[model samples]
Target: MKEEFQNYIDYHKNKGGTGKLFKFELVEYKPGFLKLKGFFNSETLNPVGTVQGGQINSMLDDVTSLLLIYESKGTIYPNSTNLHSIHHRPLFEGEVIVTAEIIKKGKTIATIRGEAFSKDGKLAATLIHTALIMKSE
Candidate 1:
């Protein structure tokens, strides 16, 4: 199962739109929790030379979704219904660590919390994600 999950993430990281661009690495993964690390390059920078809010949000969203998938062992698929992010600080160069934990897992719905931290261990943003869990056909 671990190998499968790793392969899944690798495939997306090499092929998916955001994954390909952000180059996110699946640093750690376990049931109900996961961590992804990446860097915000020049392309992700805003006009002021800081990482854009939307890019951070996208990273959180992707990490949360991947966490759910890993927890489910690929038996269920998730569709995000709601996402709320709060920015705590600006991020420029260096590594970004995204950690996600499942808050509640139900038959039909799930809630997850994700936090993004800079290389220096400062919190950059936090996100709450609500997703609909559906069985794979």
Candidate 2:
């Protein structure tokens, strides 16, 4: 885990927010790419008995945004413009590993791709996320 992101996670870990709910932990990282592990439990399940699509999307959005923020050294703040997601299989309550990488980054926009895998290493969902870049002062 990188120092900056580790600090961010530590700072938010006990804040009673969604980070705590999802239990996101950095697994691996490099420039322009990273992998995260998340725990999904009964709280994340929909009535159909699988993790809800919205929860998965939230994970995708958070991971992608974190990557962009990190790659920019916190200079490129981004507001999500769109998130295109595909559900390959239903994810149940358990550990999920998500990987995100910068697809393309430009002055005014960025594109990121992310994939979520179940504990068994099966691809469960994927996302293509776009955001409008905002430079920090």
Candidate 3:
């Protein structure tokens, strides 16, 4: 299922540098929950020997958005609400695992909670995001 989804996204969605350049693996997925792991290279690192927060946040956002897109079939999608991210620690240049779960889903919006961990399973960051489901005419 994930391979098919990734193939579809890769062929259909015009993902920018992060999506194309980085290596992301689908760790797990179910009816309303999804987990992904993103590998971070030197290009994703900050000056302090740690991966940039933006990169981690972006990975969480991307995975959560993917979950939303997979759920909402026939609709235009947008991030209509803010994503609140909390950085717990720094993830160095290595393998980072992130997981997202759908907390709630509404007609026009959905809420997802996600978390990121370092290679050693250390908590790195967390995020709560609101995704907007759109209708296209």
Pairs in steric clash, model 3: none
* True-vs-predicted CA distance for residue 74, candidate 1, Å: 1.7
Clashing pairs in model 1, backbone N/Cα/C closer than 3 A? none
lDDT of 1 by residue, 17-95 (tens): 8877667776887778888787788889999999999999998998898888766666887888999999999988668
How well does candidate 2 score on lDDT at residue 96? 93
Tens digits of per-residue lDDT, candidate 2, 1-120, equal 466687655644665366777788889988889898988889999998999999999888888887887777777777999999999999999889999999998889899999999989
Order of models, best lDDT first? 2, 1, 3
Each model's lDDT comes to: 0.85, 0.86, 0.77
Candidate 2 to truth, TM: 0.90
TM-scores, one per candidate: 0.90, 0.90, 0.87
The list of candidate 1 runs beyond 4 A from truth reads 1-3
Cα displacement (Å) at residue 31, model 1: 2.2
